[model samples]
Target: MAMTPKELLNQLMQTEGAMCAALVDYNSGMLLESVGSGMDLELAAAGNTEVVRAKMKTMKSLGMQGTIEDILITLTHQYHIIRPVEKHDGLFIYYVLDRSRANLAMARRKVLEAESQTAI
Candidate 1:
């Protein structure tokens, strides 16, 4: 069975050193659901929506011909990932991780898997 939005958040939380996870609608910058250990996901969701929007706008202006897979923002001690879902078209997943303990490569792979199996 496909995972629910909440289940997707739960799975992201299971990633090593995961700090937070949220299902966001980039078009509206809204958080559909979330789970985690640090920060207010609602604010993060809203802020990241701008991030996605900016990139999309840039892509359009540049005449880029492909879809965005994800965006990674690396901080001194954390990694923030924004993954847009192909199946859902306009939805995205925001995953925050503690840099010291998270396996970024693995977390990214897992996020992709979860996105593929998630249901709207």
Candidate 2:
């Protein structure tokens, strides 16, 4: 079934080791919706917005011609994922997972599934 933005996030959180998830507007650096705890998703949304913007700018500067499917940030204890929503311009998904317990490949697959099912 089709899922609302929040429902999609909830589904994402069901992934093993999932910590938090949010739907963000990259254009405005705003958190449209979020779930879970530990990290401050509001601030994360704003910061990651810049991350997306900088990458986009760099891509243009290099004259690269392809869309960003997703951005991955690996930390000592966590894995962060940023995925741009296909149908919604300037919108994206942010998901965090614990490195030890999560299966990176499976988590990535689930995020892609959630991205596909999400309605922005």
Candidate 3:
């Protein structure tokens, strides 16, 4: 069975040191569902939409021939991940982790797992 949006977000939050997780609509740059909160997830998710668009635009201009797997933004004290959902078009997963406690490799794998199970 496929996971619901809320279940997907919850699964994301289970990652060690996870701060926030949200299902973002790529076209509208809006959060469809979210869980956990130390920061403003809605704002961050929307901004990451711009990041995805810029990368897509660059890819098109350069004639690149691959889909974006994930975008990682490392901050001074935080790690942000933007993962485009492969099962559905026009959707992405926005996940935040604490740099001091989260394992990047595991987080990446977890996001991929969550993406695979996400239903909407």
Candidate 4:
């Protein structure tokens, strides 16, 4: 059975190094739902909306024909993830992790698994 968006996010936060996570609507820059906390999810959602749009636009301009699995932004202290929900158009998951605490490969897989279980 599929999990609710909240349940999925909750599961995601249980992964090692999870700092925060949110389900955001890229078009409106709104948080459909959110879980955990370290930074301002509202602000992050709005800012990331632009990031998603810019990536999509760039992909189109470049004639890229594939779907975006996820965008990873690595910082000195943190890792940011932007993953589009395959089942929900115009929506994406925003996730954060503490670099020093996270296992990148495992955390990334956790995000993918969480998205797979999410029911929107």
Per-residue C-alpha lDDT of model 2 across residues 1-120, encoded as one tens digit per residue = 779998999999899999999999999999999999979999999999999999999999999999999999999999999999988889999999999999999999998998888764
**Which candidate tops lDDT?**
2
The parts of candidate 4 lying over 4 Å away from their true place are none
lDDT of 4 by residue, 4-119 (tens): 99998989899899999999999899988998888899999999999999999999999999888999999999999999999899999999999999998998899898898878
Ranking by lDDT: 2, 4, 1, 3
> Which regions of candidate 1 fall more than 4 Å away from where they truly are?
none
Worst 10 residues of 2 by lDDT: 111-120
Tens digit of per-residue lDDT, candidate 1, span 13-99: 888899889999988888899887689888999999999999999999999999999999999999999999999877899999999
How many clashes does the backbone of model 4 have? Answer: 0
What are the lDDT scores of the predictions, listed in order? 0.92, 0.94, 0.91, 0.93
Per-candidate TM vs. native? 0.97, 0.98, 0.97, 0.97
Best by TM-score: 2
Count of steric clashes across candidates, in order? 0, 0, 0, 0
Worst 10 residues of 4 by lDDT: 111-120
In model 2, the runs with Cα more than 4 Å from the true position are none
